[model samples]
Target: MTKEFFTATPVKQVFDRIVEFVPVGTEKVPTAETCGRILATDVVAQTHLPGFARSTMDGYAVRAAATFGASESSPAYLEITDTVQMGMAAQAPVGNGQAAGIATGGMLPEGADAVVMLEHAAKLDETALEVYKSVAPGANVVAADEDVAAGQKMLAAGSRIRPQEMGLMAALGMETIRVFKKPVIGIISTGDELVEIGQTPVPGQIRDVNTYSLAGTVGQAGGIARTYGIVADRFDALRSTCTRALSETDMLLISGGSSVGTRDLTLEVIESLPDSQILFHGIPIRPGKPTILAKIGQKALWGLPGQIASAMVVFDRIVARFVGHISGNALSYRQHDRITAELTRNLSSVQGRTDYVRARIVEDQGRFYAEPIPGPSGLIRTLVEADGLIEIDMNTEGLEKGETVFVTLLR
Candidate 1:
């Protein structure tokens, strides 16, 4: 059966529809293994970080007023009562006309409000010290709760844990944390001309690349990918695979048979499933217009293009977004990394469709320029040779040479 799309849905609208499904459940994991996982609950500080005032330098802990008018010409001298040891409480208070030796990260002695660097002071004797400079109150000392206060929200519910966040959690004594479960995605490659990667293909056949590539993409998006092997384009075989995939995984991705053709059975199989509804069959984006999105119950199913580069582009922009949403980290969860570069050549596009042109970024005279990588979408080398993608908006017909453009980093 042949199908025609009179109108292609906008990319933003398709994303909106994809996020309508609820997110998966959460589970508690050790904080050490929580890196790159989205937090299912807010992490609040139970105790103030650095719960005590600490010295930031190896110097004398003193009252700021005691160092007034102390200079090299006439240095002020004070008796050193005791030395503050690392990880131990101060043994003596810093009284008037008295100084306490303190090391970096040592707790400040009582009545001491500032730290004077070692270079500014000289040891006149074992118990006496001379000050050459005056320091203001609170100088070279980090007050209690300066880094984080009790009850402060350290991380939001949807925040992705990074190395620094893990350190913070460790400081707060959080051994385990609740994080969103990784979504399991079932990937099935459908085509009669497809063969396993290990097998050498004969005439009119090609090795399967989409399954591995899509699986890697799923991992990059923080989802677990389960390959269902390649299925023939026959209606019964594809439908049976689809039914099992939807039941076994949180989402299903069927790559191929999206375009209208005599062998196109993806749409037919999706429609034959119980409680299945096609959210969108096509998108108004170049190289990915033949993509399909459907839902069966609470699970999502996608029909990606057969071409390697086209399938990857659709997966990166569309499938990744939905995966992030269901994992509690939506597209807006973090700022996208982008750089502005001058176009090395003019890029032309149609009026109605948005274009994602891959380009190799070059630096000359400390300025960045994007050189377009020209190749068919079916050629995977086009993406391999490019550093990032430069997008042409739907309203713009083309971009002239030497124009500045934003290059979205592939990572």
Candidate 2:
């Protein structure tokens, strides 16, 4: 079948369709290693933070009524009854006109409504001090559950655990956390003209670059990638690998064969699987117009572009989304920001197809400028020199120079 045999769906639509087949999986992992993992359940605060009313600074804890109108000329004097210890409750309650020396984080004594810092007070003897500063009720005190209330819901389900999330879990004395399991992805490259990178390339044969790049990309998307090596352009070998990979993994990715003849055999291999159905045969995307997607039972099998750059772009935009959704990390996940820049050259794109133009970002006069890199999409060097991608609408004839546009960063 020719490329005309299939109708292409937009990139965004393809991703939305595939995610319907993905199911959430859960695993219990240690909190120390939970960074980047998605939460499977809501995290509730087990106890109140601080657990008791405590001093916020090194000061004297006294009844607010006793410290009223205290000043420099005629300072209020109070007897220092006791000293509060750290991590322990006050030894005794403060009586009227009496104060207790309390350090930061020390438990506040009963009957004390405020704390006056040491800088505002002077000790005449061990028993009494002249308080020059007046403190209002409940000043400089951290009440029980002030930072966090007991049974309060903190991190919710589908939240990606970050450093701050881990710190919150540690505060609750949580050593283990329940998070979504990483999806297992099986990668297979198929072509007769492909050879390993270490070997010298003969006539009509090129190095296999798609497998390595796709595998690394899968890892960055939070999937466990298993590269099954390059399969020969025979129907039997390709079928066998697809069957085996589908049985072991949640998803399988096959790099399409470049030649017209080999592409038919690859399609036949997918057709042989039980309940296998093609989702999309061609996308209206440039360089990656030959991409395909299929579902074998519950597992997803994707046919990526033969060109290295095309394959990576389609995978990052389409397949990576499904992986993140299944892993339950979609809520807090975000793609790299689009860098604003001025286009260096005019670019043309076909209607109904979104074009990704690779460009190098330059800093001139404290402003960012995007200069389009000139090369065929198949060449790997185009991406190596690109700092970002400038997207053009399908309906636009061409984009003019000096036009401010958003360029999605490669990082």
Candidate 3:
């Protein structure tokens, strides 16, 4: 029996329909080992940073009023009380008409509000010093709570931990950090003419590329790839593998059988599963229009295109975001970098579909230009030659040369 093509849904509307039926759980990990992990709870400061006011210059610490009207012509003199040792408490208080020698980062003595740089003051004698510049209160001094205040919220939940966040947690003496658990994504490729990558293809058979490539992309998005070796197009075999995959993984991806074909059996098997609902059967997205998203139980079961290039584009643009969402990260999470550049060529597009044009970015005379790398979607050389993809809006018909656009980088 043959089937007709279904109405295509808009990409955003399809993406908005995704619900996290099984959200990733959280665990406690060492703050130092939390790089790239999404924070599960908000972080608040435990104590004031620095814990004391300190000087930022190597000079005399004195009251701002004591240095008033002090300049090269006429100098204000104050008695030198004591010297603050490095990494030690202030030696003495700065009484009226009194100054204390302080090094950079030295603790500020009581009654001292500013530091006069060494070059701005002169040592007249062993007990007296001349200030050659006027100073304002709080000048050249770091307040006790300047870096962070106690009880202040520092980091928000759902934030990814970076090297700088590690340093901040260290500064705040945070030992354990709450982070979302890494999600486990299942991958399955269905095609009778596909062979393992280890085996060379003979005649019409081709090497399986989607399983391994999708695994790498899944890892980049913080999900553990649980792969089920290539399954044939038979309904029984594919359904058996998917049953085990969904049982073992947070999400299952059936690569192939999304488009309407005699061999396209993913929709039928997915629909037969208990409590399965096909949220979307097709999307108005160029290069990956034959995509299917079904909710099987509480897990997302995706039927991706069988073509190598189309499968990869769908994973990069659509699948990765869903992985991030289930893992408690932001919905629009993307692994590839994006850059803004001027288009060097005019590009045409259909009105009802969003087009992702592969492009090569080049730098000339300090400015960057995005040059279109035009080719059929199935061409492997097109993926190799392009550094990024330029997205044209579905509402627009075309883009003009010299128009600025954002390119989603693949390399």
Candidate 4:
């Protein structure tokens, strides 16, 4: 059956459709294993962080008023009453006209509201201290709940756990946390002229690079990848594999056979599935214009171009964005690591299509410049040599030499 081709859909519309089909489920994991995982529930602090007033420097704990009118020219003298030890409570209260020697991170004694650094004060005798500078109350001291207050929400639901987040959880005495289970993505590569990586390709045949590269991208996006191996470009063969993969994985990525040709059987196979709906067959973007987004029941099914570079770009712009959202990664698109760089040369593009130009970022004299990597979309080495991608908007005709642009970092 021949199908009529529709106009390419906007990238934002495709993303909006995928958001409606995101799965909802969660699992419990140890705090140590929560890195890169998304929190299913809010993490609230059980007790105040630091729980006590602590010294931020090695100094003397004293009443702020006692140091008034003190300076290097004429210092105020006070008797040393006690020493506050590290990891221990203050032994005695700091009385008026007295100071206690305290180490960094030591608990402040009662009646002491400020800390005077040791460099600003000198020991007059074994028991006497001379203050050379004045300090105000609460100076150099962290309040009991300065970092986090009791009952405060430390992390909201949908937060992706990072190293700092793990440390915060540990500080809150959390050994285990509830996090969303990693989505399992089934990767299938299809082409009549493809061979496994270990085998050398004949004149017309090439290695199956899309599966491995797409699998790595899936992992980087916090999804578990299950490769279904390469399948021949046949209707029945592709349909059988797609059926099993969709049943076994949360999402299925079929790389190759997306364009219109005698061997392009992906659309046929996907349409043959029971209760299948095609969200979009093409995107209005360069290099990845033939990409497809579909839905089978609640699971997402994607058909990426056969070329390695195009597949990677589609995954980065579309698949990765969907994966991050479903995984509850809290970071917005603007929050992703990106930097502005001056273009080394001119780059031309059509007005109706957005373009992702691979570029190598070079730093010289404290300025960053983006040198475009010139190669066809099929060449994987071009992507390898580039550090990031510079995007050309749909309405812009081209970017001139030395024009400032934002480069989306490739991890």
Candidate 2 minimal-lDDT segment of 10 residues: 1-10
Global lDDT scores for all candidate models: 0.89, 0.83, 0.87, 0.89
Which runs of model 3 end up more than 4 angstroms from their true locations?
A: 1-6, 20-22, 331-337
In angstroms, the error of model 4 at 396 is 1.9
User: How does candidate 2 fare on TM-score?
Assistant: 0.88
The full ranking of all candidates by lDDT, starting with the best, is 1, 4, 3, 2
User: Candidate 4, clashing residue pairs?
Assistant: none
lDDT tens digits, residue span 300-408, model 4: 8999998888999888877887887777665624335899999999999987778999999999999999999999999999999989899999889899999999999
Query: Predictions ranked by TM-score, top down?
Result: 1, 4, 3, 2
Tell me which residue pairs clash in candidate 1.
none
RMSD of 3: 2.7
Candidate 2 vs 3: which has more TM-score: 3
By TM-score, who's the top model here? 1
Q: What is the lDDT of candidate 4?
A: 0.89
* lDDT, residue 408, model 3: 93
TM-score of 4: 0.95
Query: lDDT at 296 for candidate 1?
Result: 91
